[model samples]
Each structure stands twice: as structure tokens, then as C-alpha cells.
Target: MNTNKELEYCNVAVWFDRSTLHAMMQALVEAGLNVAWKESQKQFRVTVYTQHGTSDLTLLRLNGAYKLDELDYCVRDMRLALVLYQFIEQAKGHAIVKMMNQDKIVVKNIRYGEAVRIVEIKGAEKKVIYEKACSVTMDQVIAALKRRDAEERIPVMRLELDYELATLYDAIQAKDTAQVKKSKDRLKQLRQEMLLLEA
Candidate 1:
């Protein structure tokens, strides 16, 4: 195992290091993701759990030979997949993460002594997100800072939405027409603002 470097935002912590097949699994567990693996008859059975759901997998060894296709695993939940993709930074030398309705974060294990390209894709649209090495460019640093900011803000915004929905539910049950109307209006405004953030 090599020394690991950490990057964190609130409750999310991602570590980067030269990773082996087994090391990736450990990294997942260290990130507070639930993971269990065992070997039987020389085959590895692994299970990963997230707030969304669970994913079970079988692998040959701890070698970087398998690719996780989202459709092949959990079709409705991507939290597990995203968590696994972060570990690929060390396994594949680099990895790219496409955050939902957000910009992509690129992680490279090896520095190329020059700028690395980062691209963003949505539907049929593609654009360059950043090109300079983060250590040498203020633009890259600013972008990273913005992403970190979003990481913190998004969860709070979601909590606000949840609270409003719960209040609205209680008002409806109580037959409070005025409160219901107010709650609905507040929910609409919050949703619109959240949509803007996603955009």
C-alpha cells in the first residue's frame, strides 16, 4: 500500500494513492461506504452498499481488469457506482466523474508534467471544463473551489426541500387550507432555486 492523500467536502472524503485491486476495496470502506468481500473457490464476491441501495459483484482477482457498467449493476441507483469510480483514480492512472447535473471532476494518479484536459458532457453537448494543471492554474483552483462549495450547499438545499415537504404533508392532513397554500408556494420557490443550482 502507498501513502494516501485526502480530499474532502463535508461528509465526503476521497483518497488518492497508487491502488491495487484489493486496495480499492479498502478505500471504499475507509470512505465510510459499506463493503464486504470474500473468496470462495478462487472467485471473489463483493457487495457494496449505499444510501440508495446495494450492488453485488463477482471478480476474478484484485487486478484492474473489470469495468463497472451502470446498466449491468443498479439501473436506478448511481451512488454506489460513483463511489467506486473515485477509487479508479489510482487503478487506471486517471478517472473522470460526471456529477449529476454538475460538472465533471477528473482525478489522475500520475502527473504528466503538463496540463491535463478535462471535459464536460451532457446529452449531445460537450465542452472543455478545464485544461491547465490544477497546481499551476488559478482557473483550475477556482473551479475546484466552486465544486467544493456546491458539495456543501447541495445537501443543505435538499434538507430544506425535505422539511418543506414534510410540513406540507402535515398541513394537508390537518385540513389547513391556508397553510397548505403557503407551503406549496414555498416549495415551488425552493424547487426553482434548486433547479437553478443544478443547471
Candidate 2:
């Protein structure tokens, strides 16, 4: 808890899931912040240089939580941290929109029919039927948006399970115990989550 903000670093941690954490890191990187992922520590080190001084922030993940560390608590550093937080919030919104769009699929099912009598439709027609059957009213839409806003939301990362499994295999072949263990745990968790999502 160094209060001296000038030319110093401070660290804080905020709770975030893997995707939100990754989005924040990506946003910091896009904003020209020097960011590095410390794999061993499961944290991100962010350094920002200004004309007056240098500031740093570290994001650590632990027990499915996240925390941010700032180098200093000076006005400048506080301002920078605020900006970073805003950027993260913006990124989170973007991620939510992306996830919603990706998950929004045209429901294709028979309205009323047996196996012998059915119709397959997609796109606008499917949407119409779905909206009618589900009674997706304005209140529901509002409620859904509220739920999304309140949730710790993140877009699905591009990283695929197959790629992660392959990396795990490589780690095993290389006899990298730490990596093998990490990858195996991640793959197991991710696979379970994916199955749940699919269900």
C-alpha cells in the first residue's frame, strides 16, 4: 500500500473469469500498454510509461478470481487505472454482444407434427416461429439484457479444445510436468463446460 504514485507501481486484483481477463489484457495491449502474462504466477503484468512517471498494474487470478495491483496510488496512476477499467468495461460489452450474436441461432423445428409430418425451415421463418412460440415479449428482452449485464460475461475465445489437447499432448511428450498438468486440468474443465453448454 504505497501511496506514492509517481514513478512507481501498484497492484490490485479484480475477480474475472478467463475470458473477461483475456479481454481486458487484449484491450490493454491494444491501447499500447505493455502487458505480459506470467504463466507460472497466473497473472498479467501491465506497465504504462508517461512523461511524468511510470505506472504499473498486475492482474492476478486465483481460485477462479482476479485482482488488480497498481504500482502507486497517485492521481496520475489512479487516472490511468480508471481509464484501463473503462477500457475493460467496454471490452466486456463488446464480448457480450459477440457472444449473443454467435449464440443466436435460427431455431429449426416443427411447430406441430409427428415424425412423419414435419417441416425444416431456417432463418427469418424460423425466428418468427420461435418468437411466436416462446412469446418473446419486450419484457423478456429487457430481462435478458439485464441478466447479461449483471452476469460476469465473456465471449467464447477462439482457442479450440482440439488445439489445447494437442498442446497438452506436446507438453506430455516434452516431459514438461507443469505444462502437462496445467493443460490437462484446463482441458478437463473446458471439456466439461463445453458439454454443459452444448446440452
Candidate 3:
């Protein structure tokens, strides 16, 4: 897997069945996003293809994991979009549209108050992954659970929201729908935003 962001856009490279890859692909198609033409089926790519804030935000809600790198715009967004879509589906319970990238350490080379020191922003973007995956909370879990029959996979679908995912992973892992409302509420904002783009 590979990932990177440029000009409010992010790109990803993915392999088949390699964690959340499927979901990423579905999201792009479902969201009316496209795939890059340069890539072959063996190693595909996907990206956030719009400049609109809401569209971009919708694309950001992904639950995929394993970023190859932060993209440099040298590549096309279409391919990147397709690649990420695949990644989201494969990750399953481990998937989400956002994550708290705690490893960030940004420094300001300018003045103190005049220059805001950028730091501690969420890096593992679940929104992008989920959007790329084209998956809602319920569908993801259902698909992941269904995978168990194909092989020996576990029945779990981790959410792509911020706070709720932290709490929802266990619920999906346990196949418990008790907190389904909570997960929906946590993702309520993004859900509406994504739908608005489609409308």
C-alpha cells in the first residue's frame, strides 16, 4: 500500500485483497470518483479527484490502512482513487476513514505567536479511506463478516470515524450492534457531507 496528499488531495497505490483495497475502489465508484489509466490490474492506484471541500472531505473518510507514501501530484488522481478503493475493503475491521497520526512533529521556522506551530493533526485519514471504500458502517461490517465463509476470516469491520472508531472496533469485532447508533452518530457529520456531494 502507498498514500500521500498534495494540494488538498491524496493518492494511494494498492494490491488485490491487501486490506481495505476493495472498499477504496467501491467508494470512488460510489462517490462518482474515477481511476487512473496508467495503472494495470496488478498494481492499481486511486486518488481524491475534486477540489470541492465537501467532495474532498467525503473522499477523506476512508477506513483503509497501510499508506505507501504521501503522493507528490506527479501521478494522476484517477489511478490513485481506484487503488485506495480496493485497500479500504480489504482492511475490514481494521479499516476506517480517519486516524490520529500521533507521530507528527511540525516545526515553525518563523516567529512564535506570528507563526502557528503545526502539530498533532490526525494523519491516518479514515474519512478519505472510507469515502474511497464507498462504505458505510453497516455495509463494511456485513462484508467483513461475510468473508468468514469464503475462508477463515474473522467477522469484524472497524469504523472510519474519529472518536467512535476507537470505541466501535470492539463492537464490530464482537459483532455487537448495541452501539450501532453511537457509531452512526459519530459519523453523522461526514455521512451527511458525503451524501450532499452526491446530491
Candidate 4:
């Protein structure tokens, strides 16, 4: 493997499978670049035909461990490096999409056992907008469970509102003015707390 001095301090590791490489080729093609490849049982030889010149990359499987000099290639040429970086990032289940108004959206999907966690971020500041956890079969959008303690509070607060509403209902039955007002105020506070969790 060729070594790059500039990238010596950076430890970049990537695990390449057959489907991942094929998806990478598709990404390059979608980016309006000509790509050709030959794949064997344990190796892949990829060539990118560009206006500047033809760049070649070889991926080899060594004793069940795949190795390649990605940083060296990046140091030599940038066009193919960018595509490879994007493809590897996507394969790792991370993506960032830029919006028209200069805001960006980042999505990360992770799996643990049978559950999948999805996280969505919006805007340039990369604020966490939404997060949830769902089974593999139940797929809309979700996020990791580690930070779900905050979201879990929302349901509890909602349940509290339900109990308070019942109290308010009893207050109305007896026509108690002070109890009804207190319940209403408590319900409003619970609703505001839930909204803050979403924010």
C-alpha cells in the first residue's frame, strides 16, 4: 500500500462489501462520470474516465481483511476522492443534504439487534430536530435510543395531562371554580413542556 505523509495522522478505515462497491459505482455514474469496473471473487479493479485522465483504483481482500490506500489517492487526485468519500459515508448510514435556503439536513440511521434508530437534523447549526426508534419492519423515521430520555418525558407529561383533565372534569361536575382554574393552568403547563421536548 502507498503511504501519504499528509494523511499519516488521520486513521481512515472503511470496510467494503460487494453491494457497497456497486452502489458507489452507481453514485459516480449519477454524478455524470464514466466508470468501469472488473470484479473477481476477492478483488475489484475500478477505473474512472475523466476529462483530465483515467484514474485507477484497486481493492484487494487480504485474509478476510480488505485494504486500500484511499488517502494516497485523495492526495493525488480530488475528483474521485470526493465521490469515494460520499459513497463510504452513505454506506456507513450517514448522509447530509443541502437545502435551497443554505440550510442543511443530516440523517443518520443505526441498527442495534432488531431495532433501528434514525436521527434527523435541520438547519446550518445542525440542531437535533427529530429522533425516534422503531423496529426494522416499522420504518418511517427514527433516532437513537441513547438520547431518547428527553422524548420519553413527553408521553409521561401527556399522561399527567390526562389525569389532570379527569380532575378538572370532576371539578366541573361539583362546579368548583378554584379547582377548575388550577387544573386548566396545570394542563397548559404540561402542553408547553411537551412542545419544548419536540423543539
Scored by CA lDDT, what does every candidate get? 0.49, 0.44, 0.36, 0.52
Better of 1 and 3 by TM-score: 1
Query: Where's the lowest-lDDT run of ten residues in candidate 3?
Result: 107-116
The C-alpha TM-scores of every prediction are 0.36, 0.31, 0.23, 0.36
Candidate with the larger TM-score of 2 and 3: 2
Positional deviation of residue 185's Cα in model 2 after best superposition, in angstroms? 35
Cα lDDT tens digits for candidate 3, 1-199: 1234222222332112333445555666675764332234333344455433212222221223333333322322434433443343343111112211234323221110122122233455212111122334665455444443321111111123345666677778877787866676766754433322211
Residue-wise lDDT of candidate 1 within 1-199, one digit each (tens)? 1112122111112222223456778766776778887765545667887665676765542222332322223212344444555454333222233333333333322221112455555666777766653323455445445664553454466567779989999999999999999999998777544433432
Give the root-mean-square deviation of each candidate in angstroms. Answer: 16.7, 17.1, 16.2, 17.9
Per-residue accuracy of model 2 over 1-199 as CA lDDT, tens digit each: 1234322112211335567667766765665556554544576666666444765556565555454544234434444544554543433211110101222432222111101112223434432432223323565455445553222331142145557878999998999999999988887666444323321
How many steric overlaps are in each model, in order? 0, 18, 72, 3
Rate residue 126 of model 4 by lDDT: 53
* Model 1: lDDT of residue 76: 27
* Model 2 TM: 0.31
Error of 3 at 13 (Å): 9.4
Question: Which stretches of candidate 1 lie above 4 Å from their native place?
Answer: 1-19, 62-83, 93-96, 102-117, 122-125, 131-199
Give the range of the ten consecutive residues with the poorest summed lDDT in model 4: 1-10
